[model samples]
Each structure stands twice: as structure tokens, then as C-alpha cells.
Target: MIEKCSGNTLKEEFEDVFDDVLIDIGPLSVYYPPGCINRQVSEQSRKKKILRNNYLIKRNQLVLVRGASGSGKSTLLSLIKGIIPDSIFAVIEGRFQFVEPSANVFCVFQNPYSQLVCPTVKEDLVFTMENRGFSQRKMAERLTQFSNFFNLFHLLENKTSKISGGECQKIVLASSLAADPTVLLLDEPTAFLDKDARDEFYAYLAKLKGKYTIIIVDHHQEQILSLADQVIDLDVGIDIDLGKKREHTLVSENWGMIRGAIQENYCICIDKLSFSYAKDAKTQSNFCLKDLNLNIESGKIVTILGQNGSGKSTLLKLISGVLRPTAGNIVIKQGCHPLAPKEYCRHICYLMQNPESHFLFDSIAEEIEFNYRKRGDRSGNISEIFGYYFNVDIDVDVDLSRSPLLLSEGEKRRLTFLMAVLEEKGIMLYDEPTFGQDDASCKKIVTLMKKLREHNRLQIIITHDEKMAYSISDIVYRLCQGRLIDEC
Candidate 1:
């Protein structure tokens, strides 16, 4: 049975009798200093309160926390992981009692790459158990069981860097399970996974129900709600709206439409193009894109959909001149003349799937100002551009002094997108652009893409959102193995 205990006397009483109560948190409140809270602040000037009083967690309970981006769901997870006030600077007002040892709690971060420490998949999976002093036989047994469960046997010997984002997340999850933590904290675990892989992951969570205390922070409410025993709305500080559907309504000025400057027709021709990564000694699937042929024109939004590591990202890299083709050719033309490799970056811009990869400056203001000055666009103001596209005011909603690294995953994604738009390139490549965004932010992205299309800019999108793919795409291609098959 779950019991809520408040005050010093009740907490003591629960400690003596309620063995099931794994955590007893009394009138707790957490506050953060302005500009990302990088260090502890003595003065109480402009500090924002992230979490407030009376939060309780019971043993083996499945709790789901929901909120918008930058609403402190991740902050709460860090507190539960015992990282706040020590690893991350935060002001704590009250105490939280953990009945279980801190070692029994494991957190899987929102970004999978953050926790992937080992070089290869196999090593990463076993790294936790090795540090925990598990016997060799015991490690072997757990490895075999989880590898089979997650279908990660094929990727066992592959380097973590070579695998797709979704594969990296799966390996991280497997690594956490192998550690056998009693309390599992997951932050958007399925953010990078495709539909089939995501459904399979949901099934695994169902099977794992009641075995461990699982606290999940995610935007996929419909899929995860069935697994949650109790839900918390962090924004409201109460449990409500267990069955409310998320509404996405974004209205922004059509910046591209306002410009009304249509460029000369550009075309990308891929003729029997093929590319592959260097083969690993024991890897089963050495991902490659092979003998693909396509004709892409300006003023069209083309999307490619496939499973993880199906060479969707490889195609973008090759087209954007980041990687040369192993065989065949890709030619970008204005009217009829082909552009040289040296001129590729002038016309094409690539937004990587990982938002952090785009950051080069410490603060948001610096990052934006640097890119804005480099672009040398005298036509528009930076604040005006941000408002038109992202609907974010430069001075009001965002703290310009904060580090971009301190922003939430969704926030980072939006910032990267804004930087890309600032480049004013004719051709844009986006990889999983909607990965971390909430429904409302996702709508904003769609509106922006549509606006770009109206400006006659060619866009090549790599995504797994089937609904989104079908909605905005003029053409959709599905990649299998190394081959592209037209879906429409």
C-alpha cells in the first residue's frame, strides 16, 4: 500500500513502520538562480522556483511527470538522482528521505550519447556491471539475456559512434537494466526510436511493470499513460487530466512569405550514388547507402523515412558535401550548370540530429549574435527574425545570458533550427528535426517549413514521424538496407 507522510513526526513514524515507502519528501522547494543556475547563489535575486512541497514516491510505483519544455521535469529527476545541490548547483529548502540507498537509483538522460561512455556496444553494456563488481559469469548471463531482449546482438561489436541515435538509446537502456537498479528514471527514452522500435519498447516496459520504481518524463502521453499508476502535472503541481489530448496551435508571421523573394530554380540529381562506412571487424550490419537515383527540385519538401541506421543520414551528408560518395555522383545545379564542391556550403546547410552539435558559443545571445553578424544580412533584425519564425521574444521569454547547453533538449532543438534559418541557404537538410519538440513546438516547425517552401527553398528531411512525413512532404521515400524505395 502507498502512504503519504508529511512533517517530522510522520516521517519518523513512516521510517519505523512503512517499509513500502521508498521516499518521504517533506515540504520541499527547489530554486535556481537566473541564467541557467550554473553556480550557487547567495542572493535571492530573480531566482525561479522549480519544484515545490510534498512529493512522495513509493516502492515499485510507476509515476509519470508531464509538462512543457523547460518546466523542470528534468530538474526533478536530477534531484531524485541526488545530483542537485552537489553536481548541479541548486538551492534546496527542505529535505527528502530516500529509504533505499542512492546507488540503487539510475537515471537515463534525455540525450543517449551523454551516458554512452564505452567505445563499443558490448563494452558499454557491461561497463556498469563491471564497476559494480559482478562476477564474469553473472555479467555474461545478463548480457546474453538483455541483448536477446533488445535485439542488440547484431550490434554487439559495433562502435557506439557508428550506430544510429535510436540504437544508442537502446544500448543505454540495456546498460541501465543490466545494472539492476531498484529505481529507474527515464527521460524521453523513445525520442529517437522509430515506430516499430518504439512499440516494442513500450511492450518491454509493460512486462517490467511493478518490478522496479519507474518514473518516466515523456511527451508521448497516449502510449505511456496506460503504464502509469499515477501521473503528476508539474506545471499545475497536481494530478489532473489523465485523458486530455494535447493541443498544438501555433500562429506566427510568415517570414518567408513576407520576403517574397523567390530564387532561381535549383535541382539536385543523384545518379547511382553509393556510400558506406569503414567496416568493423565483428559488426553484422555495416550501414551504407547504395546505388540511389533521385531528382529533387526547388520549392519542394522531400522526406525520407526508415528504421534506425538505414542510411538516411548518410544520404544527407553526401548530398551536403560532408561526405563524398564511394561510387556514382551527386550534382547540384542552378538552371543547368553544376555547382563545384567548394561552393556547396554556400548553398546548402545541414542541421544535425543532435542539437548540441550545432552549438559553438557559451550563451544564447552570443550564439545568435555571432551567426547574425556573420550572415551580414542588413535586411532584418535578429529579434524580428526570431519572433517571425520561432515566436520567441529575444528580451522577454528567454534569458539571453544562459548557456545553450543549459537549455532543455526541446529548447536546444529550436535554437539550432533558428541558427540554420539565419544562414539563409537555398537548400536545407534537417535530420529528425521534430525529435524533442512538444506538440505546440512541432506545429511551429511545420509552419516554418511550409513558409520556407513558399520561398522556393529545397528541403531534404530525414525523419521517422510518419504522420509528419505524409503531411508536409511532396515526396516520401523509404530506405531499406541500402536501397531507397519510393513510398509515394
Candidate 2:
């Protein structure tokens, strides 16, 4: 339908450019800045297999592109969004044309933080909308429209960096909708959302299918596949089998399998805990968490699920000492010596929702060596261990010397995750551990969890992936209105 439409017709409807452009980035040689990468795999001397096909995204259809980590799903979006030929960072070597492309093509990247450019939510929207020449009155109208439309009015005053990753993803999406692009490209939109949020957002998108030409790239395929008008499996030229569809089961149905840890092996206790991002506000409605209590056991996998803004991340932060509790006690039973949250961080490894937040070094080589050096292992066996787990073609010993920031979202997650495992922290804390992971990668993580259980290590995962929680978790907790319910 879209291929038949003239550019004039689309511009008339969307008030933005909708050119019939075929993205051809082949023989497509791209080079990153010198000294940027140690391996330089993405930017090789010859044309590597990247967006090498002359693909035309059908108009007015929801096309989903699926592939494993580092597979050009994002780069394809970048090409369509015109980030390739326009940027100074990458040198392109092919004809990438956007025919009669007078209108803008906005993309909500996989990493929501990268797309958000302003300090606060409203400021970010205004900044995005104003770029398309929206007047003050029109921008204000859009700010209120999307914020309230997406149930984000309360967050208008919230700082972009201060909010949780899932909230940031919503804000970025809202900003994209407000921009009203002729082509709306979403890269893993549901990566940060909990199950409820993912369902709700997809339902909303299904309603907007006709209004916007949607192109989504996602690894989680259940609801997304059903919603797509057409599916494009990038790895192969056909729809990838996402396993059989299963009926949704009630979270309460598995209560018998959920068992609590014994007192003697108790890992941590949250006693009358409460936290408020704004402590001295004029009203009492601003509190995020209020007087919650819970207990974690060693050798058990605990999964926490909740809607967006349900204080799930807040609980993890409080336990990890990223944020101090307003009033309450987080006591850790560290080998018979009770320790405060701050003191207990040394014994626990907390993976942030955004993997980039967990990195200390710029290069992957330095990052890996830091772990091995701390243990005084100078042997070449470190690379062997890396190959065994990650199975990447690159020499595990080589630095790739690329900045951790330059790595793809999935690579960053794997790198930080790999380091944490090698460190052998007593307790592991994961916030959205399944983000940027495909089915195989998720299976690897499940296997890793089994290994952790054999050693009696505690794992507390704050996520929305129900299947993952059901697969490995011994205890499941659902967060609602600043409280944790032992659903299992």
C-alpha cells in the first residue's frame, strides 16, 4: 500500500516527508574514527555483511526486523533514519538515497537515554517537537497531549536521568509520537517494559497502526509478531520461529512452587523500608515507596515484577545502596556479621538496567583484563573462558580497544555481565537482565542461573520477563503501590 502511494499523498496526510526511498548500504564500507576500535569488526577494510540488501520498507505496514545481537537491526534503522550519511562519525561507501525526503524520520533508539536530549521530560519533548518548527503554543499542546496520553503527566517535572529506564523508554516513545514523523522507527521498544507495560504499549500501537507507518525491531516475539502486519527476519529472509505460542497463565497459579529461603540461609531483609525521591514536597502523594518489608534467601532466584513506575527499580537501588532509604533498615546477613546497604555493596554485584552505567573502563580489553588481573591470572586461559561462554569469533584476548560506549547495547550488557560473573560476587543483583538478549542468549543466562544455584549464590532479578521468572525463580514478588507482595 505504501509503495503505491506518492510522496505528495503521504506528505499531505502526515504533514511530513514520506519519500519512496530504497535503503541500499552495500559494498557499504563504513569506517569508525581511528583508534576507536581494537577489533574494528563493524568497520572493516572490506564491505562486511551489513544492510547489504536493497530493502524497501512497505508503506503503512508494521514490519518487524529480528536478529541476534550485533546483527545490523539497529544499523538498518539508522540507514532509514538517515543517520548514516548525515553523521561525521561513520564514513559510508554506497548510494543511500531518501527520494523527496523533505519530512523528518524520527527514531526511538534501543537505548532510550541516547534519544533523550533534554534535562526534564517536558524539556525533552519540547526540544524534539521544536526541531520540526512547532510554535510555543503547539509545542505546549503536544507536551500535555502525549504526557497525559501515555500517563506521563506526573513525570513532566522529572529529570531524564533520574527516572527509571522503562520510564525513559516511554518518554522517548512519547516524544517520537509527538514529533509525528512520517516514518516512525522503533528499535526494541519493549526492551525495558515489564509484561504489563509491553502488553499495554503493543495494544496502543495496534490502535495506531493506520495512523503511523510503524517499523519495529524486537527480539521478544510473542505479542509483537501478532501485532505486525509483516514480519522481516533479518538473519534469514523468512519469519523466524519464535517457539510455540502459549496461553498466558495467572501469576498466582504457581504459588506452590514458590518457596521462601530458610532463616539460617537468609540473604537480606528489608524491614519497614520506605523511600521518596522528593522528601520535602508540599503534598504526601509524591512518595515512591512506603514502609515495605521483605526477605531474600541465599541460593534462591527471586524475581520482582511490576508495572512501570511501581517502585521496582527503587527497591533494587535501595538494597544496592545506590540510593539511601528515607527511613527503614536494609540488613544484610553477611556471614553472621550484619552490614548496612553501603557496606554490603562490596559483596554484591548489581547490574544496572542500562549496561553502559556499569562500565568503569573505556575498552573491552581493559574491562576484561581488570577482572583477571585482580585474581592474578596472567595465563592465556582467560580468552578460552570468554570463548566458551560468549562464542564470539574475535580473539578474546584482544582489546578490540573500542570504547565500551561504542559497543552495541547487547554487547555492553554481555561485557558487564561477563565481568560480574568472573568477579564471583556473593550476591548478584540484576535489573532487567533480559534486555537486549535473544532467545539463545536468554537460554545461556538461564543455564548460568542454574550454575549459580549449585553454588548457593543468591540472585535477585527485577524484570518484566514472566517466562524467565517462571523458568528459574524460586520466589516471585510482585510490586504494587510501593509494596512487595509474595505472589509465590
TM-score of each: 0.84, 0.79
lDDT of 2: 0.69
RMSD of each: 5.4, 8.2
In model 2, where is the ten-residue run with the lowest total lDDT? 245-254
Give the alpha carbon lDDT tens digit for every residue of 67-143 in model 2: 76655678768767877646534555443445436656888888766677798888986777888988888888888
**lDDT tens readout by residue for model 1, 1-488:** 11223447345665656668776665444555454454312222233334445556778888887876766688778878888866876666555667666547888888887678889999999987887789999999999999999899999999988777788899989988888878999998998888899899899999888999999997777899999987766552221222222222122344542355346778999999877677441332444777799999999999999998778888999999989887789999977889998899888879999889889987776787676667565446656655555455545454566678877788888888777776677898999998877666777888789888888889999998887889999999999888899999
TM-score of 1: 0.84
- Candidate 2's C-alpha runs over 4 A off are 1-46, 52-54, 88-97, 118-120, 126-128, 134-145, 157-162, 236-266, 278-287, 340-343, 376-400
